[model samples]
Target: MANLLSLFKTSGIFHLTPGMVIMWLISLTLIYLAISKQYEPLLLLPIGFGILVVNLPLADLMKPHEGLIWRFYHYGVQWEVIPPLIFLGIGALTDFGPLLARPGLIFLGAGAQAGVYVTFFAANAMGFSVNESATIGIIGGADGPTTIFLAAKLAPHMLGSCAVAAYSYMALVPIIQPPIMRLLTTREERVIRMKKLRKVGRLEKLLFPIISTIVIILLVPAAAPLMAMFMLGNLFREAKVVERLTNVAQNELLNIVTIFLGISVGATMNADNFLQAKIIFIFCLGLFAFCVSTAAGVLLAKLMNLFLKDKINPLLGAAGVSAVPMAARVVHKVGAQEDKKNYLLMYAMGPNVAGVIGTVIAAGIFSTILK
Candidate 1:
C-alpha cells in the first residue's frame, strides 16, 4: 500500500487540481479559436498547447531551473532576447515607402496611444501598482512582442495573463474594431479618399532607418535594444546587398523565435498564478484599452481633417495600432465597404507601420518612468 501510494502521488492524475482542469479548458478554448476560428493561429496554437502542457500536474515544465519551458522562458523571454529578434523580423518585412509617402499619418500612430496612458490610470485606480498598471496598459498597443517585453520587465508575475490578453485582442481586431470605427465616423468621413502617395526614392528609403535610429534612440535610450534591431533589419532590406540576411531574418529566424516565444509565454500561466480575479480584470482592461485606442485614432483623424486641404479617410486611423497588416487590412476592408473604388491599403500601411514604432516608444517611456 505504501508503494502504491507513492506511485499514485507521482502520477499526474493524482496530483491534478480543479484549477488545472480549468486551465486546460482555457487552453483548449484558445486552441479551438486558433484552429477553427483561425485567430492568430501561428502564435495562439503554440501558446494554447503550451498552456495545456504546463498545467499537467507533475510536468514541472516551468520549474525554475530544471525544466524545458522554464529555460525557454528564462533565456528567450526573461533575458529579452526573443522580442527584439521578433522586431528584427518585422523590420525586414516592413516597407517604409508607405510611411515616408505621407509623414502626417505618423500623428495618428502617436495619437492612438491615448489608450495606453488612459488605461494606466484606470488600472492604477483599481488597485494595481504603477508597474503592473503600465504592463497591463500596454495591451492597448496590440503588439504582442511589446506586451511580452513590457510584462517581463514590469510585472513578471502578470506576464502570462497580460500576453494572452494582448494577443487575444490583437486576434479579434476585426470584430472589436469595426463597431468602434463605424460608431465614431460618418459615412462621408469613411468615404473620403486621399490623393495618391508620391513615390519614395531609394535614397530616402535607405536614409530613413538610419535617421530614425539616431533620432529615436537618442531620445529614449531605453528603447535602443528593440529600436536598433528593428532599424538594422529595415536597413538590411533596403540595402539590397543582403538578400540572404533579409530572407533569413524575416522567415527562418522569425519562425524559430516565434515558436519559443509562444510556448514560453504560455508556460508562464500555470494554475497557481493565473486563476485570480485580477486576471479577469486584465482581460477586461485590455479590451477596453484596445477599443479606446481604436476610437482615439479615428477621432484624431477626423480632427486632423479639419486642418489639411486633402481630407484623409478617417478609417485609415483605425490602423494606428501595432497589429501591422491585420489592422491595416481591416481599415481597407471597412473603407471599401463604403466605397468600393477607394483603395486605402497603402495609405493605411503608413499609420499601421508607424504604430509599431509608436508602441515601442511608449514601452520605452513606461520603462523609463516606472523603473
Candidate 2:
C-alpha cells in the first residue's frame, strides 16, 4: 500500500488541480480561435500550446532556473532581445510611402493614444499600482510586442495576460472597430473622400528612418533599443542595397523570434498567476482601452476635417491603433460599405503605420517613467 500510494504520487494526474484544468480549457479555447477562426494564429497557436504545456502538474516548464521555457523567457523577453527583433521585422515589412504622402494623418495616430493615458488613470483608480496600470494601459495600442516589452519592465507578473489581451483584441479589430466607427460617424462622413496624396520619393522614404531615428531616440532615449532596430530594418528595406539582409529580417528572423516570443509569453500564463480576479479586470480594461482608442481616433479625424479644405475619411482614423494592415483593412472595408467606389485603403495605411510608431513611443514613455 505504501509503494502503491508513492507510485500514484508520482503521476501528474494525481497532482492536478481544478485551476490547472481550467487553464487547459482556456488554452484550448485560444487554440480553437487560432486554428478555426485564424485569429492571430502565428502567436496565439503557440501561446495556447505553451499555456497547455506549462500547466501540466510536474512538467515544470517555467520552473525558475532549471526549466526550458524559463530560459527562453529569461533570455528572449526578460533580457529584452525578442521584442526588438520583432520590431526589426515589422520595420522591414513597413512602407512609409503612405504616411509620407500625407503628413497630417500622423495626428490620428497620436490621437488614438488617448485611450492609453485614459486607461492608465482608470487602472490606477481601481487600486492597481502605477506600474501595473501602465502595463494595462498599453493594451489599447494593440501592439503585442510593445505591450510585452512594457509588461516585462513594469509588470512582469501581468505579461501573459496583457500580451493575450493585446493580441486577442488586435485579431478582433474587424469586429470591434467597425461598430465604434459606425457609432461615431454619420453615413455621409464615412462616404467622404479625401484628396489624392502627393507622390513621395524614394529619398524621402530613405530619409524618414534616419530623421525619425534621430528625433525619436533623442526625445525618448529609453526607446532606443526598439526604435533603433525598427529604424535599422526600415533603412535596410529602403536602401535597396541589402536585399539579402532585408529578406532575412522580414522572413526567417521574424519567424524564429515570433515563435520564441509566443511560446515564452504563453508559458507565463500558468494557473497560479493567471487565475485571478485581476486578470478578468485586465481583460475588461483592455477592451475599454481599445474602444476608447477607436472612438478617439474617429472623433479626431472629424475635428481635423473642420480645419482642412480637403476632407479626410473618418474611417481612416480607426486604423490608428497599431494593428497594422488589419486595422487599415478594416477601415477600408467599413468605408466601402458606405461607398464601394471609395478607395480608403491607401489613405488608411498612413495612420496605420503611424500608429505603430505612436504605440512604440508610448511604450518608451511608459518605460522611462515607470522603469
Kindly report which residue pairs in candidate 2 clash with one another: none
Model 1 steric clash total: 0
How high is the CA lDDT of each candidate model?
A: 0.95, 0.95
Q: For residues 1-371, write the lDDT of model 2, one tens digit per residue.
A: 99999999999999899999999999999999999999999999999999999999999989899999999999999999999999999999999899999999999999999899999999999999999999999999999999999999999999999999999999999999999999999999999987988999999999999999999999999989899999999999999999999999999999999999999999999999999999999999999999999999999999999999988988888989999999999999999998999999999999999999998999999989876
Give candidate 1 regions above 4 Å deviation.
Answer: none
After best superposition, candidate 1 residue 78: deviation in angstroms?
0.6
Whole-structure CA lDDT of model 2:
0.95
| lDDT tens readout by residue for model 1, 9-83 | 888999899999999999999999999999999999999999999999888999999999999999999999999
Off by more than 4 A, model 2: none
